[model samples]
Target: MSTEVAAEVVVAPPANDAEEGTKQSHKLERKWAFWFDTTKPKQGAAWGSTLKKAYTFDTVEEFWCLYDQIFKPSKLTGNADFHLFKAGVEPKWEDPECANGGKWTVSGSRKTNLDGMWLETLMALIGEQFDEADDICGVVVSARQRGDKLSLWTRNATNEAVQMSIGRKWKEIIDVTDKISYSFHDDAKKDKSSRGRYSV
Candidate 1:
C-alpha cells in the first residue's frame, strides 16, 4: 500500500526567550500560514490545494524556519508562487477580504530585488508596518518567467486616503526602482482599468 501523508494546513512557531532570560512578548498573536507551490504542472490542482504548508508561525523563530525551507523567489519556476496570508485567508482574488480589496503592485525584472522585495512586503503586511495596517488584507508574490510581481492587498479599494497611504509606505519600505501601481478590485474586474492611480 502506498502511504499518503495528509498535507499540513498550517504550522505555528513557538516563542523564544527574552534578553533577560524570559519569554518574549508579542503584541499581536496573529496566526499565519506560509504556503509553497512546487507542483510542476499548475493545471492539475487548484492553487489552494497545491499549496504545501511549510509552517504556520506566530513567533519570529518559526517564520524564519518556514522562509528558510522554501525555494526563494529567485529560485522558483516561472509559474510558481509563494504566499503568506493570515490563517484561513486564502490568497485569491475572490476571497471576501480580497473581493473588495485592491493591491499595490511593484513590478521588475531584477532577480535580486524580486526575492528581497517579496520578503519586505511580507514584513510590511504581518508586522503591520504600514500606516494603513487595518486596510491591508494580505500579500502575494508572482514569480513569472517574464517578470516578478509583488502586490499588497487591501480590504477596501475606494478609500483613497487609506489606499494612498499604504501605497506610499510600501514604496518607502521596499527597494522599488520605480513607482508602484494601485489597482482596485472593481476596476480590475472590469475589462479594463481606467488609468488607475499610481503613487510615484
Candidate 2:
C-alpha cells in the first residue's frame, strides 16, 4: 500500500440501513488499522518509512473484504510484514501505545499453516477474545527468509500475570502447544537477539 491510500477509515453501513434482504455487517468492539511494510527497503531508507497505514475498519465485512485482497498475510514474502493494531496505535515501537509494550511471539516454519494462524489471530483480535483485551496493542505477521513469525503485541511489558494469561489464551486460540515467548520492545531495542522475559 502507498501513503496515498493510507488511513482510510471504513465504517460500514449500519444493519438498520441495509436493503430489505441485505446482510448485516457486524461491528467490532474497537476500530482496527491495517499496515504493511514492504519486503525490501531501499538503500538508506528511513526506519518505518516503508510502512503504509493501509486502512481502518470497524466491521466484519470490511475486514474480510480487505483480508482477501492485500492483507492475505500468507502471501507476503521476503521481509514483508502485515500489522493489525487498534485504530489509533501505530505498529511501531516508538508509538505511545506500544512504546513500553512487549510481544508474545511464535515462530512458524514451512508446515506451520501460517495462513490459518493469521486468520485465527485476526478473528480473535477483532472478536476481542482475550481476557486481557485492555492490555492488547496489536498483532503482526512477518514473512522472512528463515521462516515466518506471528507476534501478538501488548501495551505493557512488566505486567507478568497479564502477559502470561494472554500468551496462554493465544496458544489456545491458535491451538498450538508449542512454547510461546514474551519479550519487551525495550529489550528488543537493546538487543536484537534478546531472549524472552517470560514463556508459556
Candidate 3:
C-alpha cells in the first residue's frame, strides 16, 4: 500500500509601490528639532553650549524613528532633559521665539507615566491639536530624581486668552486631573520663587 501526501503553499501578493509610498510618508505642517541637555556640562562652557541639537523631523515617520532611537523621559538620568521645538527655534529662554513667551508646566512623581505624557504632548504640538497652535514654540521634559516635569512653551506669555486656552487644552489632552501652571520665561529666569501667571 502507498500513502499520498499533499503540501500547501502560500504566497504574498506583489507590493504596491504607490500604497507603500503613501504608508511610508507623512508630512507635518512644520519642521521640528529635537534637543538634549544634561546636568554635567563641559567645564567653563556657557549654558547653551552644552545643549545639543539632536535631530530634526518634518514627517510623522521620521518622528517615530527618532523617538525609538532616543531615550524616554523615564529612562533618562536625573537632570537630563529633552526638548522638541519648531525648526530654527532654539529651546532657550534667550531664543527670540521664546524670550517673551511662557510655559505651561506639569510635574509628576517617578511613579507617573512620564513617557506617555511626553509622547502625548509631542503629538499635540506636531499635530496642531491646540487651538492656539501658532502660539506654541516647543515642548520640554525634564527628568529629575524626585520627579519629572513637562512643559509647553508658547510665543506670547502676556496673551491671556491664548495662553489660557493653550493651558486648558494641554491639560485635557494629557488627561491629567491635576492643575498645571503657566509662567513667563522672564519670571522663571528672574526668580524661581515666583508663581505661575496662570493655572488650569
Can you list the residue pairs that collide in candidate 1?
11-56, 12-56
**With candidate 2 superimposed using the best TM-score fit, by how many Å does residue 39's alpha carbon deviate from the native?**
4.1
**lDDT assessment of candidate 3:** 0.80
Range of the 10 consecutive residues with the lowest summed lDDT in candidate 3? 1-10
lDDT of 1 at 12: 34
RMSD of each: 4.7, 3.4, 12.0
**Candidate 2 Cα RMSD (Å):** 3.4
Q: What tens digits encode model 2's per-residue C-alpha lDDT throughout 101-152?
A: 9999998753557888888999999999998998999999988888789999
Task: Give me the displacement of residue 161 in model 2, in angstroms.
Answer: 0.3
TM of each candidate vs. truth: 0.77, 0.88, 0.85
- C-alpha lDDT score of every prediction, in listed order: 0.68, 0.83, 0.80
Clashes of each: 2, 0, 0
Q: Summing lDDT over every window of 10 consecutive residues in candidate 1, give the lowest-scoring window.
A: 1-10
lDDT of 3 by residue, 60-95 (tens): 877776676553676677888889999999999899
Ranking by TM-score: 2, 3, 1
Ten contiguous residues with the weakest lDDT in model 2: 5-14
Identify the leading candidate in terms of lDDT.
Answer: 2
Model 3 ranges with Cα > 4 A deviation:
1-24, 42-44
